[model samples]
Target: MKRLLLLALMLAPVPLAAQDMASAPGGTLRFLDKVTGRVQDLSLSRGQSVALGRLTVQLDECRFPRDNPAADAQAHVTVVDTTATRPMFTGWMLASSPALSAMDHPRYDIWVLSCDSGFVAPEVTEPEEDPDAPLEEINEG
Candidate 1:
């Protein structure tokens, strides 16, 4: 009877606050190349993949709170290596706490940086020609 009660309790569903969280439109991931001791940042859309050293990191999805984007960002990714038949890491990784769900590779480390939803690239406008400045001499000679 005690074992049955324990089993029932273990099977009970745990409630989560995930419904309150909003999904990010896109995200950026940071990776550390253990061999070169260099850190690199990679930007990727959902389902996009980038090469990191000998491994390929693919961003699956990203999510964050609509009201507090910086507070926490979560990303689902899959890291594959050419040398290995199986993927090194494939799961959700949190930006605030990367160690919580980190890549288990020896040569590379990856973590989530931020979610870029509604991000607008800054516009570049050529400076207005100085109307008062003298024009350069023509070099037709």
Candidate 2:
């Protein structure tokens, strides 16, 4: 009887985090090319895909705290290696703690960066034009 109950539970369908996913207008992912030591950032919408190296990363959904986006962010993505016969990864990943649920690939590492409702520049900068700034003069000698 106990074995039967356990078997039933094991056979039952498991639900993904789709309901808990926070809806957003946009999503972004970052992938590290371990072989070349280069990082690539990809911006995508729901059901969008981007290719990095030999892997194709597809974003299913992205969400963030409505109150404070920076507080936390999560994304559902599917990663596939075009050269492989099976998928590399497919699941939800957190932005703050990527290592918690990360891809275990030898030459590729991918993670969620954020889920934005609209375009937000990742970096901010200001022009610098100090006339007194020091400049090194090259010596031909």
Candidate 3:
């Protein structure tokens, strides 16, 4: 009887965790720009990637219906600089373009994820290292 009770409890449906849900691209398409040059950006669903010139592209602002917003939006996209003899900083590390702003306002909260793997599509949002609010104090006293 104890075993059966445990099994029943285990079988009970657990409440689903709140995930950042967004829409995925239905198909793939080539991303392009006149001044920047050809881009290999492909959208398997209905999301968009922001390209900062030809050097870098931030694959964020995924508009897929089923995706984790926090994860998807915060993907890192680092584009290497081709012609820097001694570059101090990495090329286009976080090219956040805020693509959602261009799309319909209602879907701003949506996140894009890979239709196959279900991972966040690309760079959409990132962690804020330095916030405007003051940090909590820890006095030695």
How many backbone overlaps does candidate 3 show?
21
Instruction: Please give the lDDT score at residue 44 for candidate 2.
Output: 90
Clashing pairs in 2: none
**Shift of residue 110 alpha carbon in model 1, Å:** 0.5
By lDDT, the better pick of 1 and 2 is 1
Clashes of each: 0, 0, 21
Note the residue pairs that clash in candidate 1.
Answer: none
lDDT of 3 by residue, 1-141 (tens): 999999999999999886554543332323444444544544543234343332333343233235333333322222223443432122211113435322222211222223323554467787777777888999997
lDDT of 2: 0.85
Prediction 3 global C-alpha lDDT: 0.37
TM-score of 3: 0.24
Candidate with better TM-score, 1 vs 3: 1
Kindly report the root-mean-square deviation of model 2 from the true structure over all alpha carbons. 11.9
Best-fitting candidate, measured by lDDT?
1
- The candidate, 2 or 3, that scores higher on lDDT is 2
Top TM-score hit: 1
Q: Report the number of backbone clashes for model 1.
A: 0
